[model samples]
Target: MPYLVPPHIPSGRIADGAQPALTADGGLCLRPWEYTDAPAVLAAFSDPVIQRWHLRRADSEDEALDWIEQWQEAWLAETGIHWAVVRPKGGTSDGAEQLLGRVSLRSLMLGTGQAECAYWTLPAARGQGVAPRSVTAVARWAFDEIGFERLELAHSVMNAASCRVAAKSGFSLEGTRRRGHLHADGWHDMHIHARVRDDEASCVPVEGAGPGAP
Candidate 1:
C-alpha cells in the first residue's frame, strides 16, 4: 500500500525532522509551542486585529491549550510548522519566553520545494520590528537549513502593515490574486509575495548575540 497523502512529500524530502529552536539576533527565539504557553496564547489572540485575519481564537485557558496541541500534532505529521516568537530571559516581565508573536510555514509541499508563510505580532509587540525580524530569521532557516527552494507569503491587499513585513523580510511582490478567496467581510484580493533560495534580495539568517538583522 502507498501513503495516501497527495502532493506527497516522501520522508526523505523532509529530512530536517522537527523544527529546531532557532536563536536569532536581538534575543529573538523561535521555538516549538508548549502547553504552558496557553495564557499568553489567549492574551495575544484576544486582540481584534488578530481575530480579523486568523482562524484561531482562544478565549479561555483551555481553548488556548487546544490551540497549542494542534501545532504539536501538525509537527508530528509534518504537515505544517509553527513557532513561538519569544524574547531572551530578563528581557521582559514575562522573562525569557515573552510571546512576541508567531511565524509559521504551512501548506507544506516539500515535494514541490515550497510552502506558505504566515505571521502576526501581538499588539504590544508592534512598533518593535518583531514581525520582520522574526520572519527573516524563520525564512533563513526555511531556505538555508530546510532546503525549501521557494517560500510564499500572501495577505489581504488592504493589509498595509503585512505588506511592509513582506518587503522588509526580503520577499518580492509577485502579483495579485483577484477575489482569490472570500472573507468574513466578503471577497478579498490577495497580494502574493515570494522569495527563492537563490534570490539576490533574499534575507540573511539571524545570528545570535550580535548586531545583525533578525
Candidate 2:
C-alpha cells in the first residue's frame, strides 16, 4: 500500500558520462562544459548585462577556469548540474563556435528532490529566445531524466526579460520575495517561479525559505 508520504527518489551524483546530450530546434546543443570552454566563459561573464544579474563574475582566465571547476565539483558532490548552451550549427565568433548561454540545476536540495534553475546568456544570444529554449530543455531533463520533483527560478523583479523567460519556459510565478536580491544599486524585490512534476497552468508558492539562489 502506498502511503501519503514524500516520494522516494534514488540518490545519485551527476556524472558527465551519464549526462544526456539534449538537442533542440535552431541547432542548439546542451552539453557538459569543457576545459576548452574557458575563453568563452571569460567572454560571457565580461558582459555588463550578464554580470549585472549574475553577480558571480570570472574576472580573468584563471577565475573562469576556477568557475568551471566549481561546477564539476558540484556535480561530484551531487549539488549541481550545469550545461554549456551551445549553437553547434548557427552561431560563430572570431572563427569559433561560441557559447549561446549556460543553464544550471543548482541548489540541489536532495532531501526534498528539488533544485534551482539559473542561467546567463551571451550578449549576442539575447533577444533571440536562447535562454527560454535552454531553460525548457534543462527543466525537462531535470524532471524526466533525473527524477527531480521540483525546480525553481528566481530573478530580480527589475529584470523584465528574465520574468518573460521564466513564464515562457513553463515556470509559473509562485510568489515574490521582498528585498531579496542585492544588486549594485540596492536591495531589490524578487519574483519566484517554479515548475513541478505535475504542474499545470498555475502553481502554489513554495513555503518557508524564499527562492533566492546565487
Candidate 3:
C-alpha cells in the first residue's frame, strides 16, 4: 500500500520554508539526498563517531549510491523523510557542502499519527546545536503539517548528546528499556523520549530562543 499523508493535515507543500537549500543556523541546510552525494555520504559514514552511534558499515561507492537511491525512492513514495545535512557555501570554515549528518522519521503510522525519529552528525557539526535544530524543524513539521500525534526518539543510554537533543526538542523522557541492543561493549539500555501533539506549545520557535530554551 502507498504511504499517505493523514487527511487531517493541512494542505500545503511539503518543503515550503523547509526547502533542501533552506539555510539554518551555522549555514547548514537540510536537503534531500542524491546519488551524487554517495562519496560524501560514505566519507561521513567513515567517521568513527558516526559509525559507533549509527552502527553503519563501510561501503563501496556503488553500495553507497544504492543506499541513497533507496532513500530517494522512499521519500518520493511518502514512506518517510530523509535529509542530508549540508554545510552551505561560505558558512563553514571550509567552503564545502560537507555531509555533517542525516536525520529521518520512519515507521510512520499516519492513521495513528506517530513515527520514530533518528539522526547522527559528523564530529565537525557537534556542539553547534545542529542535531537539535534539525530535529526541532522536522518534529514541528510532523506535528503541524504532517498531522502526527506523537514522535518518538530512542537512543542508547550512553548517547548523552542524543538524549540532550530529545530534551531540547520538548520530548519528555518516557522510560528505559533494558538490554535493548547487544553492542560490542555489552547489552545496552535504550532510553525513550516522546513528544505529543498536545505538547505543541512546547515547540521552540525556529527563529528565536537560546539553546534548550524551547
lDDT, candidate 2, 1-214, per-residue tens: 7657654454563553466678754567888888888999998877777778888678789888888888777777788888898877436645556677888998888767899999877766766777777777787777777778899999999888788778777798989999998999899999999999886523222212111123
TM-score of the candidate numbered 3? 0.80
In the range 1-214, model 3's lDDT, one tens digit per residue, is 7766555433233433343434455556888888888887788778777777677755788888988887776655556778887777776667765777788887766566678888877666677777777777777777776678889988888877677778777788999999987766678898989999878535542432212210
Query: Relative to the true structure, how large is the alpha-carbon lDDT of every model?
Result: 0.76, 0.76, 0.71
Q: Give candidate 2 misplaced runs (Cα > 4 Å).
A: 1-7, 13-17, 89-96, 200-214
Off by over 4 Å in 3: 1-26, 93-95, 200-214
Q: What's the true lDDT of residue 23 in model 2?
A: 75
- Which residue pairs show collisions in model 2? none
* TM-score list, all predictions: 0.85, 0.85, 0.80
lDDT of 1 by residue, 1-214 (tens): 7755554345554534655888765678899999999999899878778877774577799999998999988877777888998886888775554777888888988777788888887876776767777778887888887778898999888777787778777899999999976777898898999988887544543222111111
Better of 1 and 3 by lDDT: 1
For candidate 3, the per-residue lDDT at 144 reads: 70
Clashing pairs in 1: 133-214
Error of 2 at 4 (Å): 11
